[model samples]
Target: MAQHDDDRRFSLRHLLGLVSRFARMAAFGALASVAHAQDAVSTPAGPSIALFYGANPPIDELARFDVVVVEPDARFDPRAHPKTHPAWFAYVSVGEVNPHRSYFSAMPRTWLPGVNEAWASHVVDQTAPEWPAFFVDKVIAPLWKKGYRGFFLDTLDSYQLIAKTDTARAAQEAGMIRVIRAIKSRYPKARLIFNRGFEILPQVHDLAYVVAFESLYRGWDASKQAYTEVPQADRDWLLGKAATIREQYRLPVLSIDYCDPADTACGPATAARIASDGIVPYVTDGDLATVGVGPAGQP
Candidate 1:
């Protein structure tokens, strides 16, 4: 696991070559979302991290670690997490709205999903200029006001998938940028972090407080209740993005590679190798929804 820290400097250029291959995937929109790190954000001593799936983090397991990553729904109250854990993140996706969220009902039909691929999770229209602002004002601001340390932005690729026009793409990009700007402008001290931002890394990295490179290699399938193989392209893509984010963006990173809650996804050996890729890895279900009472999250 320690090898990634030692070899990252060497792999920087090699990974950028891989990024060139899948850049076309930007059809969704060429935008990235990032939350910048604040003074409060730091590498945990021995840097052990605790990751939780629900609105509330398992503080009992977290107290022993330097950091905790928890999902933040509108229902979540950041004040509920322990004060002793200096690094805390509010898990929210600026790219898409979950069908279960309170505000999903307020979305207009025009802003709904264009396709249902990649698990039928709801996708939104980032082309709308005000949409990102709504997320900032309504969701982000509320979390910040609650005294949360930072954000964990999931599904950033959704915007690129939904927007069809260059204009839509531009607006979509602006929307993500606006979300970051709004937060930094209001709370300069607050850290903003993003997850798995391969397609939009060029536009988004500068604003991030941290870069979360998810599933850099093979992981588990929660739905199938088994371990699964992450595509070589996907793995290469994440590796390249990680290299870019680290070298060009100069950002700290964490790897959330879900090996299934079942633990049968990747063997312990592979899981260890995932951590060696210059990230603080996690083993969770990668839950994307909050209000929906269901089995765990993503598989």
Candidate 2:
């Protein structure tokens, strides 16, 4: 009878122990849920970006964004902006040169082998050793002196349009990489934002501050000379590239979708669509002079 009593007591104690353990686990899980909810509430928002290729806009308006890309002007001073001074980036075309550029007159004729008739800018032979030096010293240094520490490097792979063969394209790609490395070496603190340098992204992703691409949903069709919907094939290709950039490299992405500046519905709707893909979206006209709708659908 004593043995029977002891066995009963052991079973009762074992059941109570299990109940206690389960209760502890349940309480721990509940606490974790509460912590996660708090974290969701308190986490800071991502960078809000704006791009304006024109000269100075209202500093108060530009200060609204976290990052702003503008055309380099000798007169524009970032320090004069509001307390929430946006990180200003100067627009620099790496794969092409415009006739209006101060250094354009000095470019060797051989370096201007191709012309982008759409924008009336000449495609540069980035492979030339002289090009990177000229660019760093002549083009970028003067802007740096003007207190512009950030650069929006555009048309990085536009040389591919004129590259005759795979080998030629690879050489151009290598040259572009050299230019990027040179920039980083020269100014380690400069924020470099690349505009669709997808070919060389893997090589320079670590050096970049942000990877920006255009035409996710809508953009100016150069061939058609109209603002049109981005074809599905092209859209899918860009979407895949963006996803890999975000998922694999863990980099922030910005996408520009061109819409009529006057089309309020299109601007907000397109911005919303691009934002849905976890990218910062700026829907503006091709000129990019007007401040348009942002990811929040705010103008």
Candidate 3:
């Protein structure tokens, strides 16, 4: 009887030991899985950017980009649902009013300084109080109703081109700030991508979803009416400025370099070079009329 009792006790101890070992193993496995998940959440995939102003780009291709900017009114197939794409942004020029825009007919004549001969667009007087109201109620609300969740605010500083003096530039800067604040207050959740709003970046850096600058490697020379390589000095300045902006603001920076659409090698080569600097790159033609190099490094 004593021997049997001793045997039973030993069997119970072994079973308990086995159970404790499995429990420890399971706990460790769970911890490892959590650590891997945390790492994945912290380190996101590389960013991709695309800009297509032309009509009816391939929907499947547009969907591949992490973000895309397009002309909202450019007729697209209703089935594309591009207006509802989470990152598809409508292009909005804050500092210039193009005659082709729907609101141009209603734009006040006093708001214009003169035509930006390069693009045949009228520069806006950002200092005008009416402009912000027009932008919020007339320009942006219509697009919001159409389902756009974001705006690519281009030409944010085009007023600088005609400001002509330090005082005038300061006033324009203040005006831009007011407009940005109004937009943010109206739609706090809307994603805003600013195109080279460097002058006012410090005040509104946190408001930006992304900061983009054009012509890091190649660009359109309005004077020559053709594509041209960016000067070395200009490239260096822009690269350093971009790095500073990225580090200081902790904002994602995107570089849009113009290249000949027909040149197959230009797209990938420019993208690779720009990517080397830890910046997201999108190489496209000057007109931005066709899809070009995207995140995949090729068109």
Deviation in Å, model 2, residue 288 alpha carbon: 0.5
lDDT score for residue 269 of model 2:
84
Off by over 4 Å in 3: 1-46, 77-86, 297-299
The reply for model 2, stretches above 4 Å from the true place, is: 1-46, 73-75, 82-84, 222-225
Candidate 1 lDDT tens digits, 1-299:
68986588558766776676567455323443112232122221124444576644445555555555566653556566546654777778777776777677777768775654556567766666677667777777777887786777777767777777888777777766666677677777876667765556677666677777556665546566555667999888777776677677777666655544445534344445554555544555546222111111111
Question: What 10-residue stretch in candidate 1 is worst by lDDT?
Answer: 290-299
Q: What C-alpha lDDT does candidate 2 achieve relative to the native structure?
A: 0.83
Supply candidate 1's per-residue lDDT for 66.
55
lDDT of 1: 0.61
State model 3's lDDT: 0.83
Tens digits of per-residue lDDT for model 3, 159-254: 977899999999999999999988888999999999999999989999998889999898988667799999999999998888778789888788
Provide the RMSD of all predictions against the true structure, rounded to 1 decimal. Answer: 16.3, 4.8, 8.7
Per-model TM-score, in order, reads: 0.69, 0.83, 0.81
Model 3: lDDT of residue 282: 88
1-299 in candidate 2: lDDT tens per residue?
Answer: 99999999999999999999999999999999988876543331357788887666656776677788888753576656535568877889999999998889999989988999888999999899888788898878888877788999999879987898999999999999999988888888998889999999889899988888999999987777689889999999998998888878878788888998777789988887787677888888888888867756245
Q: Least accurate stretch of 10 residues (summed lDDT) in model 3?
A: 38-47
Candidate 3 Cα deviation (angstroms), residue 271: 0.2
